[model samples]
Target: MALMIISSVVATPSGNKDISVAIEEMERANYFTFVMLINMVPPNLFQGNVTFLMPSDRSLSRTMVPAQNSVMDLLLRHSIPSPLLFDHLLHLPTNSMLPTSNPDLMLKVSNRGRRSLFLGNVKIVSPNICTHGYSVRCHGIDGVISIEKPGLASPITCPRVASAAAPLPLLAPPSPSPSPSSAPASDPPHGAAYETSGGVRPQMELALTTWMAFVWLLYSKAKLCV
Candidate 1:
C-alpha cells in the first residue's frame, strides 16, 4: 500500500483558532514549502501558542530536509512556543536564548540597530506575517534554522588571589639594670669624718689618751718635789 500523508489542524480545548489558520497564512505569504512540512505532522500533536519562522520556498528547496523522526526537530528549531511579533522580537536583547516547543532546541537572538535582527542562522526578512490569530505567529526568515548537537559546555577559568608571606616574630634584646659601682657616691652625715671597718669612733679614742698623759705627768712632778 502507498504511504498516505494527511495534514490537518484542529482547535485546542481552549477554543483558540486552529493552528491550521497560521499554516494557511504561511501559504499566503509564499512559504508553501514550510506549510507543507507542517502539514506532514498530525494536527493533534500541536498545542498552545506557537511562532513559526518560515524561509522562502526557494530556501527550503535548496536545503536538504531531515529524516522522518527529525522533521519535528526541524520544525521546533524554527518555531518558538510563544506568539511574538516583530516588535516583540526587536525588544529581545542580543544573545537572548528563546526556548522553543522542544525543550532541547533554543533560538538565540542577535539584535542589531534598526530593523536588523537574527534568530540563530536565520534572519527575519518579513516581520509580523501572522498577526490575525492569538495562538500562532509567523514571520519570514532569510534561511533555514540550523540544527546542531547540544550538551557542549563553555570553558571557565578561576582567578587566583595573591598570597602574603607570614610575618616574622619580632625579638627585642633585654636591657641590664644599674649596678652599685656605676652609681654616684652620696655625701655622709655632718661632723663624721669617715666610717671604719671596726665600727669604733676615732675622735673618742684621741680624747681619752690625751687626758691620761696629763694626769701621769702631774703625779711625777709632785713626787719628785716631795
Candidate 2:
C-alpha cells in the first residue's frame, strides 16, 4: 500500500525550523514512509529533543503500516526521549538499555562496533542522517525495533554470591607488672636522716668523739703524778 503524506501545514509555536530541516533531511535520504509517519503525528511532539530510529522504506514496505490512532505510540517506541547522535550511540556498551520516549519501553543495545550497532532487533544502517537539526537526530535502521516486555529478564545480570561475615578484631595481651628489684628507686623524704632509728651512723660517731676527750684528760693527771 502507498503511504499518504499530509500536505496541510501544522502550526507550531516554536522549533518549526528544526523540525522542517529534519523532515527535509529524511526526505533527502529517501525515507518517505517515515516522513509521512512524522507528518501524521502532532508537531508539538517533535518540538522537544528527540532521536528517531527510522526503519528503511524497503523494510516498512514489507510490514503493515501502523493505524492513525496508534501511530504516536509506534513513533514514540522507535524514538529516544533525548537527542542522541550515532557517535553517542556507539558509546553504549553491549547489553546496555536505553529508555524510549514511551516510559514503559526500553531499547537494548548490542554495540560491537560502528557498523555492528544494533538497537533491539533493528540494526542502524544509516548513521546521523538528520544531524542538521539542533534538537532532532535520526538514523536509518534495517527493521522495526521490537518492544520488550517488562516481565522479561533484566538487561544486566548480577551473580548472587553469599556475603561472608566480617572477622572480629584481635585484642592485645595485658603487660606484666615490674618486680621490686627491677623497679627504679625514688629519693627519701626530707628530715628522714635525723630520726633515731634512721640516723644510727650519726649517733655512733658522736659517742666515739666524747670517749676520746675523757681518755686524754686521764693521761694528763697521770703525767702530773709522775
Task: Output the number of the TM-score-best candidate.
Answer: 2
Candidate 2 structure quality by residue, lDDT tens digits, 1-226: 1222232222232366787998899999999999988899887777847899999888777766558767788788889978899999999998778888888777778899998998888889999999887778889999877665442124443322222223223333233334456344663332344454536446555656765665565565555445
lDDT of each: 0.67, 0.74
Error of 2 at 113 (Å): 1.0
Off by over 4 Å in 2: 1-14, 148-226
* Top candidate (lDDT): 2
> 101-157, model 1: which lDDT tens digit per residue?
777667777889546897777789898888777677889999877755232111222
What residue pairs clash in candidate 2, if any at all? none
User: For model 2, where is the 10-residue window of minimal lDDT?
Assistant: 1-10
